[model samples]
Target: MARPKLPISATILVKNAQDTLQECLDSLQEFDEIILLDNGSSDDTLTIAREFNAIYGNLVIHTSEFIGFGALKNLAVSYARNDWILSIDSDEVLESTTLVRLKELFGTLDSKDLDSKTSESSALDSKNPKTPQTPTPPPNTLYALPRKNLYNGEWIKACGWYPDFVTRVFHKDYTRFNDNIVHESIMLPKDARLVRLDSGLKHYAYDNITHLLQKLQTYSSLWAEQNTHKSASPLKAIVRGGWSFVRNYFFKKGFLYGYKGFVISVCNALGVFFKYMKLYEATLPKKPRSCSLIITTYNQKERLALVLDSVRELAVLPTEVLIADDGSTEDTKALVESYARDFPCKLGHIWHEDRGFRLSAIRNAAIREAKGEYIIIIDGDMILHPFFVADHLAFATPKVFLQGSRVIVDSHTSESMLQARSEENAYKRVFTLGGLKARRCKILSHLVYATSRVDSKFFAQKDFIKGIRGCNMSFFKADCEAINGFNESFIGWGREDSEFVARFLFNGGALRRLKFAGIAYHIYHPENTRDMLESNHQIYLETIHTKAKFCRYGLKDL
Candidate 1:
């Protein structure tokens, strides 16, 4: 049999998408041709696309009339020459795997499937001769692509941002966009067989707060205009405006999206509020819901006890305290158990075995067990500054995952730990006579391969606190689960936290270094993790440069 030709072309609808157009085009280079519809660009958008043609194998550009968003898209798609078409916006980029998969789907395109219709069975004709209408699937026609949107520079892994169902690739004859004035939904045939693509669209829709507000204003203005012309009443607009904010921000988990997401929800609310407020200035009223609190934790017995006491003493009690613990052998378990039994408010603890030092694993394990609608994670060793949890909860919304911070203990305390910890180079908790903090850097690295004895000062200065610590961090339960939880392979005391945070932020998880919002005090302890740190450090040195889908059993082998 002859190899099937890849029947795919990509179409992009653009209007001043200059700053982000090249990255978009680069992602779709595999397609046979690119039809760019520029409404009217004062920028180098067209010039850049033309320039890309030199490097990209095949590309075609078409300028469209600035009629409207949907009309412009429709006009652009009308010019595509290929049987199958892929559409993307200027702010999005395709993952490599997604591109390969799309091509594979194209090569196997079945023309006959798109043309087939369902046969009516004679047996059912007696009762209801008039057959019910069943929409046909978009055979070779429609591909439901995943769009991962990033707001305020953070990839929103949750809050309905990532894996958004967008109809990107399609057969030219069947798919067409509707001609709505604002916030228009896509129009497709009833029988469209939508195949979801594994690849994701990295969308930087709003780079910051200013951009987000601007877009909201445009959308709201357009919406009001459309509704005003549709015989909308003042009361209806008011109700819808209030409901929209409540629905998206509180009900849909927008609060979990962090500051950017919270802003988006607020903008969404404003869009609804303003649209109605403009439509019926005197009649409309908007009411916002109060915020909910969430908490996260792991193995610190004394510290956990302190947090529990502080929470009980709070003026405004949290909706709940979510204590997430990795398996703890010391009083940590007892602390959590006691909180669950004696605490006045709703208290819960998620417990897992003391596996290796997989912070992500522990975090994920705990998050799954969270009961609060919104969630926040904190370390056990740190003491919260009363309003710490309240501050994050205050900013809660479905679209936001608040990132909190931790300030180290007083200089004197740190100085004391530094001095006391620098006494031995290879300090192991098991061998160090019940101490929890170890002061041995040479015991773990090849730098001490020759010398069994370790210098405390050198070890403390070199290895004690270089990477990002998980002592203070918070996000939505839904968002964390969406990213498949944190990477579980970084099972060591060093660099793992930084590595996971980098992934979370890069994948569009918004962050806010709570700096002054949540203050925490680090407790003193004899080093308990010397052996595990040494082992994990060696693995980090060996494969630190390697970024794989699954980090090959870093410390699991031992």
Candidate 2:
């Protein structure tokens, strides 16, 4: 007589998985039954499933709206026809060797041994009446297999991607998937004998970088929604992002894959950052308002002209322009007035006497005179991208001040840009001779913007704060007023911005770092005098020591 077929069923949950579903089904031809639970798929996924069922007699297909991975997988398990169920995703393909091993393992299980195990499991379940009794497996049969994930046409052997052991093969009676919306795993009975098969499964996770980013966006949003009840700050997100990169790249030996490894590691960090950022945003109130661009200036009239020209090219213009003049020459005033005629929005200047390094004072004067509900502050020497204003507005949330970053243009590029003085030309040269960091920023701007983490931990780090320049920062007018604005007591340029940020945090305002979106090109110039560095540092220290949210010598004092 012919031997009875091994009682094994392969199950998968799918949604728009046309690309890999065929390969996955083909790989499981040896199984007694194939159970497919598909979420709503507008693509050719259902057609392919039907074709496979026609070709293979044991194929079973079910359609449902996705509830959660855990719940959906359990539903798939319930539809499985055989005693042993091998759970897999639509994107995964089991190896031929793994199939052989699974068959061999299942074939060895004696029916008498299974009956004894089931009796013992029932007795244990009776002893603990509070615990729900699941199906019991045979005496010695539970299986796990390593999964090799593919990304960007490459097998990522490191960065915590390899040897991804999943407990997929289990007796239908003894195990079920945990109820997690994402990253769901199988839950095994305490008494089930677990075994890891030498053969593995191939997981085609992402087709390319774009695919990875799309998933990152979707997954992060879902994670944030799920975690809305949990408390998360921007600082915690930053720390988690940074630590994720380090752990995956160095400790996980992701460096073995070269550039691809680095990219993967960075993407991993970004996932963490975006999740927390969304979570932080959920806590804030939403109120739309107009914005005023506050440009601080001293000298550099030529560069200031280019700055205004760039502002004119903005996709979304500020409601008004406030030039916070710190005792500049008549030439600077003339430049501002000249642009006022052609500038897209209302333009005005807040001029003060030529007192040395009185940026804090001039900014306060401008803030008091400003009419817009929001303020985007940048130095006159810093030229902005067309999307700068729009990006800030897109990410704007109440009770949060945005601290943005800039790409440093070397002195040569600065001169080149000054001579051209065109917004288009300035943006074109942002990648060339603008320095290594600038090129990197230009290439990965979107990723950087998506994952920029601003948390208290990053704020507290001195070296990290250096990247958080006032050259590109935005805040709500009300929030600025609450903190009494920039501390005019800060004599020089050094710690004025840092002190202000510290106070903002102390007042329960969260800081968000804008990486690529609110980018500015900082024109290189001679270093400012740091003679007041010691005094400024002392004042900043005092702010921290006293836990002072409002400075006595701020905008109001001025």
Give per-residue CA lDDT, model 2, range 1-558, as digits (tens). 333444778888889999999999999875778898989888999899899888767789898887877889999999987777889889999976565445445553334335434322222212222222223446345667778899876889899998787888877777778887777888766776666655669999888878889999988987887777888889999999999999999999989999888888999999999999999988665755799999999888888887887888888999999999999999999988988988889999889999789888888899999998889899998888778898888777777878887887888887877777754555455545335444325436556544665545544654225555788898899999999999988877798998888888878887767765676888899989899999988998888777679988777863
Clashes (N, CA, C under 3 Å) per candidate: 37, 5
TM-scores for all candidates: the values are 0.43, 0.47
Off by more than 4 A, model 2? 1-4, 108-141, 285-558
Clashing pairs in 2: 135-173, 135-174, 234-455, 235-455, 235-456
- Per-residue lDDT tens digits of candidate 1, residues 269-301? 677677775656432322113222333444556
Backbone clashes, candidate 2 = 5
Off by over 4 Å in 1: 1-6, 108-140, 228-235, 277-558
Worst 10 residues of 1 by lDDT: 425-434
Query: Positional deviation of 313 in candidate 1, in angstroms?
Result: 68
